[model samples]
Target: MKKDLNGKITRGTQRTLDAFFDAMTALLQTKPFADISVNELCERAGYPRATFYNYFEDRDDLLTYCWIALSQRADSADLASVESSRRVDVALDAMADLLESNTAMLHAVLAHNPPDGPLFASLHRFIEHNARQLMLTCVDRDRFDLPADLIADHYANTLLLVLDWAYLRGHTLTRAQLHDYVHTLLRGVE
Candidate 1:
């Protein structure tokens, strides 16, 4: 009986979080983050004001959570397989797909009057972690004299730069085109 009650509570919490994310995504598309208020978010989420506070400290906190969730979704889609030469291709495709799927939300966030610092930081961390993992997998330590940490850092920065450029340029490249571009950029950098 107690376990059943706990499960119900957990399910309700998950539903609330889902509602919050959906509402926030919609709100971000329509207005800058600064203009969005707790009341608006609560109303859009169809949850009480108190329920919003129970889950998040404020709008920024909720935005950070949303960013993290996006990262996790990307990571899971891109990195669930074993590392190989094909990993880069998989990741590039996943990134392009993410951009395509979240076009409106991304456009809103990217074009926000004032950039969201926490969201950018979260995205940076996600890219860095994945880039480091890819570097460690693809670079041969014995053949290349570069330090692993340096290689990781370089790849991470390069990956973020590529992503920023694509976003700023409005994702002009198709998925296949971006895949080829990434492969070309990363080919001999061991």
Candidate 2:
């Protein structure tokens, strides 16, 4: 949604933005994010191509927005309210399920990108940042003397790689199974 001159989201922009989100999600179900174009998105949303520009700088930007929105919605599910290693495992199980639930969209968002692409970087940064925030609340002393950022980065990268590995292996791992593996591995930290 584009902001008005005053920089507030305009009254009608939310409607168009919702339409764009729905259209983009629909396209993501059938094609990779790279294959979806502004022309197709605009036609599907029944909005003009210029209208897409009024909001997003490009398709990548729109896809990033979608991913961010997914994380935001997942956040409201109370992942952070959990504590203790036991509850952490439960929280992770829920998180894994949430991520996997968006299977088609997640695959489309990740599959076409190189390791250094914006989407990968965005997800990496997002996971590391969120891990830092979670450590602030959930970790007492972080169990090691390393810089907090470094530990968080490593853990975040591990989580991401494990998830990627699971998907690469045809998703043979159940959500609970994945969560248990990650939790068991990280329990060594304490």
Candidate 3:
């Protein structure tokens, strides 16, 4: 969402954006991402095509916006200020809670988007990027022989791989199990 001169989205603009987000989410439950069209989104939102263009370039852009908005809502904590050793636990807890709350949406997306599909790939990349960012900030490179980037990427890959298996592949593990698995796996690294 574009901000005004003060770098803040106006209440009205935020409302409009939320309309589109809600529309996209509602559509996703029944329609595949690829099958959804701009017209459909606008109609669902009761907005015109011109109005959508004012905030987004296309459906793909809107999808990105939706994920980002969802992620932001999930990440309500200041993880950056958290103790390094606890950051992963806290981050995973937040994400697990988010996924648990949005299981229906997740299942809908997974049903349409195969592991190698564009939508899945986009989500995977976004998650990996987030994991890498957090790892880079929280990791103490001096504690490991590997370079920081490699360590960060490793941590991110581990996170993404585990999450994909647990949630994306229809597995039914509880959040507590996920935390235990990740903690046990990362004990050496931590």
Candidate 4:
């Protein structure tokens, strides 16, 4: 009934969900999330309205799922391999690569004018969790100058801000430049 970490949706359920996402992605390009209707989603997905209900309670649930899916991919080894200190640059490069690879899809999602709450929350949680874990692994807890919780929170917020800036600015900086900027930003944190 539920998808695995690998994103393997059960056959019947997967098809419906896949269609739903496809439709949502398509519709998002033309309208805001609030403007998209379940009926319209069903129509785009080529499934009946009942089919949409069978998978998701509503559009919000689908949006949450999409965020979770993207977070998972972002946190995977390919993207996560960069050390915490370098995560900013790594994130920038990865995002740029993704945007370039799927410009249309990214544009569609961003154009949708989706509510920022769920997306922000999802990213905040993911970055906080990873930053905390990375700090624990790399630094001696007793020697650490800052509270673990505080450090994690700070890093998470910084990452989010940097990402938002980059996204809004259309990623003008090169990957190396972005990496240097992140290092400078982190170094300044006392």
Q: Among these predicted structures, which one has the highest lDDT?
A: 3
Off by over 4 Å in 3: 1-6
- What is each predicted model's overall lDDT from 0 to 1? 0.68, 0.65, 0.80, 0.61
- Pick the winner on lDDT between candidates 2 and 4: 2
In order of appearance, the predictions have TM-scores of 0.72, 0.72, 0.88, 0.72
Tell me the deviation in Å of residue 175 in model 2.
Answer: 3.7
What's the ranking of the predictions by lDDT, best on top?
3, 1, 2, 4
Give the per-residue lDDT of model 2 (tens digit) for 44-157.
989999899988888877766666556656633344466545545554554576677777766664556544665566666666566556544554444578776665555555
lDDT of 1 by residue, 1-190 (tens): 1112233457777788789888988887777667899999999999999998888888877876676556556634434354555655666666556666787777787666333354556566666776677655665456558786776676566666676667645557666666666667766773
Top candidate (TM-score): 3
Please provide, for model 3 over 1-190, each residue's C-alpha lDDT reduced to its tens digit, 9 standing for 90 to 100: 4323246777888898899999998887786778999999999999999999988878888888888888877854676688777777787877777777898878876676676787888888888898788778777767889888888887777777777889888777877788788877776667
Candidate 4 lDDT over residue span 1-190, tens digit each: 2344366556787677677877877887788677889889988989998777766777877776665555555523443455555554555555545445666666566655542644445444665565455443443235457776666566555655565556543666666665666666777563
Q: Could you tell me which residue pairs clash in candidate 4?
A: none
Pairs that collide, model 1: none
Q: Worst 10-residue stretch by lDDT in candidate 1?
A: 1-10
lDDT of 1 at 33: 69
Worst 10 residues of 4 by lDDT: 134-143
Give model 1's TM-score versus the native structure: 0.72
Scored against the true structure, residue 62 in model 1 reaches a CA lDDT of 80
